[model samples]
Target: MKNLNEPTQENVEFMIEEIKVKLRMATAAAMQASSFTVERYEDIKDLYEVVASKEKFSISEVEALVSELGQLRK
Candidate 1:
């Protein structure tokens, strides 16, 4: 197995692009679902309000949701 911590330039670039693709897909899926669907709209709306409100967004929570959002895209 390769050393996970010691990533090469190519590996880093691939990871970055992969994360970008996932983020974009996650964002699109979220927007579509939130706007058109009603399954989890209330929950998502609450979360969005918390994140987009006058207060600052929670970094850890958003990062955690990024993974959850990526899963939701699938």
Candidate 2:
């Protein structure tokens, strides 16, 4: 994205929500568990990294989603 180190509060908030939407969309596409391969894993990893980079404390929230995503694909 925009090199989000020390990003503005508004930008960080927007990004957090944006990442959530992206994850949701990806999850929808992968609900059958067929798309749970390397590409989807990388996308989730990138989403977590983007959120974690801006707000360390929020990593757990994303982690939960990531974990659920994995389980759903299994």
On TM-score, the leading prediction is 1
User: In terms of TM-score, how similar is model 1 to the real structure?
Assistant: 0.34
> Which number leads on lDDT?
2
Candidate 1, poorest ten consecutive residues by summed lDDT: 29-38
How well does each candidate superpose onto the true structure, as a TM-score?
0.34, 0.31
How close is each model in CA RMSD to the real structure?
Answer: 15.0, 12.5
lDDT of 1: 0.40
| Per-residue lDDT of candidate 1, residues 1-74 (tens digit) | 22324334443333333333434434543433322233333443434334334343355655765655444331
lDDT of 2 at 38: 38
Model 2 ranges with Cα > 4 A deviation: 25-47, 50-63, 66-74
Model 2, 1-74: lDDT tens digits are 65445434444444444555555544543344333443344454455465555543344665676675555243
Error of 1 at 3 (Å): 51
